[model samples]
Target: MAHKLRLTRKHQVALTETAHRNLKRFCDESGLSPDHALTFLFENASSVFHEETLPHRLRAFKAALAAQET
Candidate 1:
């Protein structure tokens, strides 16, 4: 028999409208519920981290910092 893990805690996060829209679109297209999409992403977190999928704002901040040195 396969064991199923129960997620007993709820985690809430705030996102910009654009981010939320994109996430919703992705979930809709992939046929995954929001919770399941999050679970799937969590399970493959290492790959996402390795790919450096930082949000656009954060990437822009990094670029700004680098430009200051030039």
Candidate 2:
């Protein structure tokens, strides 16, 4: 049986311009509203982390943001 998803929590996030653009593109291509896409991603995030280079990519992403803040 497929598990039903419920959006039971909310948090605000600041997205980089590139991230925002990519998210918009993904939403358009997938025909999912941003809310549904985000909810689905959150529910399935473990799969996302399975990409071998994701940890490296995450560090680079964080470093870039830190550089912007400095």
Candidate 3:
């Protein structure tokens, strides 16, 4: 089971080719599909944004994955 919330946004930017590829690789490495991985991230974003813990690790993980695509 999962909780759902309304997430309002001011603007939406479609994913770039590089970003899509990077996210796909990250998802694959993490054993998740792109959609599932995104859902997972948003669900836990509160912990990530408010808490001063683990965001650096998450950023590093994303950076490493992004680096692979470049």
Error of 2 at 36 (Å): 0.9
Please provide TM-scores, in order, for all candidate models, with all chains considered together. 0.59, 0.73, 0.44
**lDDT of each residue in 1-70, candidate 3, tens digit only:** 7856444443344897998898889798999866666766777877645576577877998999899999
Which ranking of candidates, highest lDDT first? 2, 1, 3
lDDT: the better of candidates 2 and 3? 2
Cα lDDT tens digits for candidate 1, 1-70: 9979667668997887987897799799989887777777788877765455467767898898799989
**Model 2, residue 42: displacement in angstroms?**
1.6
lDDT computed for candidate 1: 0.79
Structure candidate 1, residue pairs in collision: none
Poorly placed runs, candidate 2 (over 4 Å): 1-4
Tens digits of lDDT, candidate 2, 23-68: 8998999898888888877778988556788889989989998999
Error of 2 at 61 (Å): 1.9
Whole-structure CA lDDT of model 2: 0.84
Clashing residue pairs in candidate 3 (N, C-alpha, C atoms within 3 angstroms):
none
Model 3 misplaced regions, further than 4 Å = 1-13, 49-70
Give the winner by lDDT: 2
Worst 10-residue lDDT window for candidate 1 reads: 48-57
